[model samples]
Target chain A: MLSPKRTKYRKAHKGRIHGLSTSGTTLNFGQFGLNALQPERITARQIEAARRAITRHMKRQGRLWIRIFPDVPVSVKAAETRMGSGKGSPEFWVARVHPGRIIFEIDGVSDTIAHEAFALAAAKLPINVKVVARQGEGA
Target chain B: MANAIKLAATARDRAGKGVARETRRQGRIPCVIYGAGQAPVMISVDAAAVARDVHASNFVTKTYDIDVGGVSHHVLPRDVQFHPVSDRAIHIDFLRIDAASLINVSVPFEFKNAETSPGLKRGGALNIVHHEIEVRCRPDQIPAHITIDLAGLEINASVHLSGVSFPEGVVPHVSEKDFTIATIATPSALRGKEDGEGDGAASPAEAAKA
Candidate 1:
């Protein structure tokens, strides 16, 4: 799983994703990309699962880039805990992904392989996604 | 010089988000033609036609003869905005140009002789720094696409802008530094093996296990 090695704060507030992403919306390093269609908090485990799906489908032939990182620490309270206590310890990391963000990018793969790989990866994600191609590169 | 693609367009009376949406509902894309010191003309072109051209190679550098109602305007595709979810062409900007117009355009790079490159044969990845290079040239002299020959490039070798030969009268927009366009990068699997040989350092997986 992908997580930050160091941080200034141990835990972060649960932020709301309001609008479409302003950046990382285009395919920068690859011919095909997986674009998010809804806002969600993607955990590190989900990202790893999606990455494994993509790489396994591609047979590790092409290169893959994870555009988003799990930097926001998500804290959780223990079961049956009282409400008067303080915030719980950091449990896991997540990335706040807004709509229209390119979550994954792949290169050096055929059109059929890229689409199939993205389809396999999308099943592991919580949000709706679409396969996108670089302009003038794929159908 | 490449031949101009002819497209039929109609002059539009309004310009706004609502009007653009309405045009899209009618299976037409809202486009504006401006530049060359002339007033901007709002027009609507067939959505399917614009989508086809947008997906074609060298869309920005390609010249277009858009026939607006009756008047034909010589223009170049300045920009294209796509719908976020559907990946459809929502809006397009066309810059009017003439024979003497000096325009700056980003030309796509078409790599050649990749099989002949020693680096590529060794399973090295061609890391492209710039998919397109901005160049200033006349509308008539704009190259379709810049050819990058990777015939004898070796592992770790880089192709710089200064080493590329552009067509006559076509000059790179950036001249201050010799910017690297692409490089033959060593594969991560090979890099790990080389690092282990140089220093007896354990790989990430081995370190994690420890």
Candidate 2:
């Protein structure tokens, strides 16, 4: 007796092994919580660190990075725009990571040293760092 | 001797979108001044004066003396909203700067020695990934423009973020070292594929078929 020829192999196995995704559109990573430092609580040291981190990262990476430090007691209007009354700004400080970019979203922490540490850490990233911010309604 | 334009403006009494629309109908641009730890003050700027500045690529970081309500504010461009279809600046935002406050702004990048660079002479092309970089410094310490020197770069040579130098008090926002800003690369062969013209000389089989 002759065996039945296998005609449906490609169709049955193709495009299914990848599991749960549809083609054509990009993948969605979803959102995460973000924090902003209180202006009055931020220290000079944090601001200095932020500056240093930005400088150092720029040196190690071949891309330009921007340190976005919000002015303390930022105007209500400015805050509305910067933080966006809707969901707040997704990024406060941004840096270059090869083939992509990295941003830091820190709320209530816009200080000299905090910014410095953030930058210093960003410079050491071995892989892509995409810092996104998602702020919920306040308590 | 210099192209100095005197413009007039009005202080916005009611601050909101409705007021802004009325201002625009009168051929004016709504703007605000903030910084120096003071509340943001809403003002109107001459629509024409703002349109002129918007034409420049480095308008945002560039300093300007804006007179509003009989008071002049030392400010820099902050943000601008543009018309979606026309892409013309419809609204503008200005940030007041105290000479002493450290400010972060992006400076225009200017390439120098490009014509004589080895990369270009050797058939390699220069690709500028970025046209500008943001910097932080005092108002007086702000740089007018940033310079990128492409001297003897060879094919595949890249200039990174760390390679750039900043004027005193002006520093890049990134903390990484050796981040790339621009690169010299061999031009893509696919560029001419659509037109079927290039140095990729037709294959023997293709030549024979032709």
Predictions' DockQ, in order: 0.34, 0.01
Per-residue C-alpha lDDT of model 2 across residues B44-117, encoded as one tens digit per residue: 87777667567565566567777776787777778887542233566777787777788788776777897778
Q: Highest lDDT: which candidate?
A: 1
Query: Which digits, one per residue and each the tens of the lDDT, describe model 1 over residues B20-100?
Result: 898999999999999989999999999887677786658888899999878999999999987766778888999999988
Q: What ranges in model 1 sit over 4 Å off?
A: A5-10, A55-62, A109-116, A135-139, B194-210
lDDT of 1: 0.84
Error of 2 at B10 (Å): 0.9
Model 2, residue A35: distance off in Å is 37
- Write candidate 2's Cα lDDT for A1-139 as tens digits: 0111232321211111222112211111112111121112222234334434543432222122222232222112334255445433222222111121222332212244344545464444333233333211111
Chain B superposition TM-score per model: 0.90, 0.80
Report per-candidate TM-score of chain A alone: 0.96, 0.22
